[model samples]
Structures are given as C-alpha cells and as structure tokens.
Target: MSELSKQLQQLQREIKKLQRAGTVPAAASAGDESKVRFTAKGFVSLRSKLGLSAREMALLLDVSLQTIYNWEAQKSAPRAEQVKAIAQLRGIGKKQAKARIAEIEAAQA
Candidate 1:
C-alpha cells in the first residue's frame, strides 16, 4: 500500500508541474466541468478562429442557427451539455472542424 501511495503521489506531482508549465489546462486536470464558462466573446472568437460561419458552428455544435447567433450575441448561454460540447470543440483546428461539419451534413442527407 505504501508503495502504491508513493507512486500516486509522484504522478500527481508530475501533473502539477505540467499544469504550471501550461502544458495542461487547469480545469481539465482538476476534473471540474463547472470551471468551463461561456462568454460571447470566446464563442465568437472560437467560431472565427475555426474559420466557421455561424451556420457551420451551429452544425458542428449540434445546435440551431439561431442558437449560434444567440450565443454570439450574448442573448443566452449554453446548457451544461452544450458547454461540454463547446469545450470539446476547443481542441480541434479548422480542417478538423470542417471535416466534422461535412460529416454532419452527410448524416443529415
């Protein structure tokens, strides 16, 4: 038991060091979903960064066009599940996002 505890402690110390080095997002290592926050600025920035239009973002996020507009306009916030979906989108690049959009359109066909 002592050996196992020591190994766990060592792993945790490594994680903390990685976090401090900015290699890991703090909330991710902390396992706290509530640490995810929604902001219109962030939403729009992420949308434009992915080179996606509002409609494309809606498709990628499995939301409605109006919902995309609402989020960008700060008229409303995403639900918890939607927030998780949005968080997942943060890691991908434009090409991957476009591919995902294509998948969505194909499925809709």
Candidate 2:
C-alpha cells in the first residue's frame, strides 16, 4: 500500500484498539456511570418513555429548558447524576439502556 494508505490503516487499527479497550469517548459499557454517552435521541427517548414533555422534564431535572434543548441538540450532555435520574425516571437500570434503545428502534420499524 502507499504510505498514506498505511497510515490510514494504522489509524483505523488504533481506533479499533481504543474501542475494544472501551476508551472511545462515546462507547460506554452498561452501568458505567463515568462513561455514559448521552445522545440527544437518548434524551428524547427517555422523555417519550416517561410520557414527559420537554418542559416537564426540565422541571423534574431542575435544569433550564435551554439546557435540555442543548442536550437534545447535541450541544451538551447531562452530568452523571442527571443521567442516573433519567435512567431511573425511565424505569430502567443503567445496564438496560441498550434494551431501551432496541425498543425505540423496533417501534420505528
């Protein structure tokens, strides 16, 4: 392969290594509070799962509406405690977050 191609391959391999080591910033293991990756859609899912509007969720989370909006827009994420509260509010264990994701995906099918 060309030198550039080789470098790209090396980078890809490094990324894979990081991902396997659970080092990717967005890839969090179940119940790993410190590694939780909160996406905008995740927030929306929790809100839907709990039948909560944005305003209601903001109230319950004790955060400004803009903060919630920012999260949903991928501008920012909640802190660990907030993530735990969201998990609890959705009637989910931290490990079960993936299951909820599956449910969300299936519902859209």
> Among these predicted structures, which one has the highest lDDT?
1
What global local distance difference test value does model 1 have?
0.86
Per-residue alpha-carbon lDDT of candidate 1 for residues 1-109, written as tens digits (9 for 90 to 100): 9999999999999999987765665566778887898889999999989999999999888889999998888889999989888887876779888999999999999
For all candidates in order, the CA lDDT equals 0.86, 0.66
Q: What is the TM-score of each candidate against the true structure?
A: 0.74, 0.49
What TM-score should be assigned to candidate 1? 0.74
* Each prediction's RMSD to truth: 4.4, 12.3
Candidate 1 Cα misplacement greater than 4 A, ranges: 2-30
Model 2 clashing residue pairs (backbone)? none
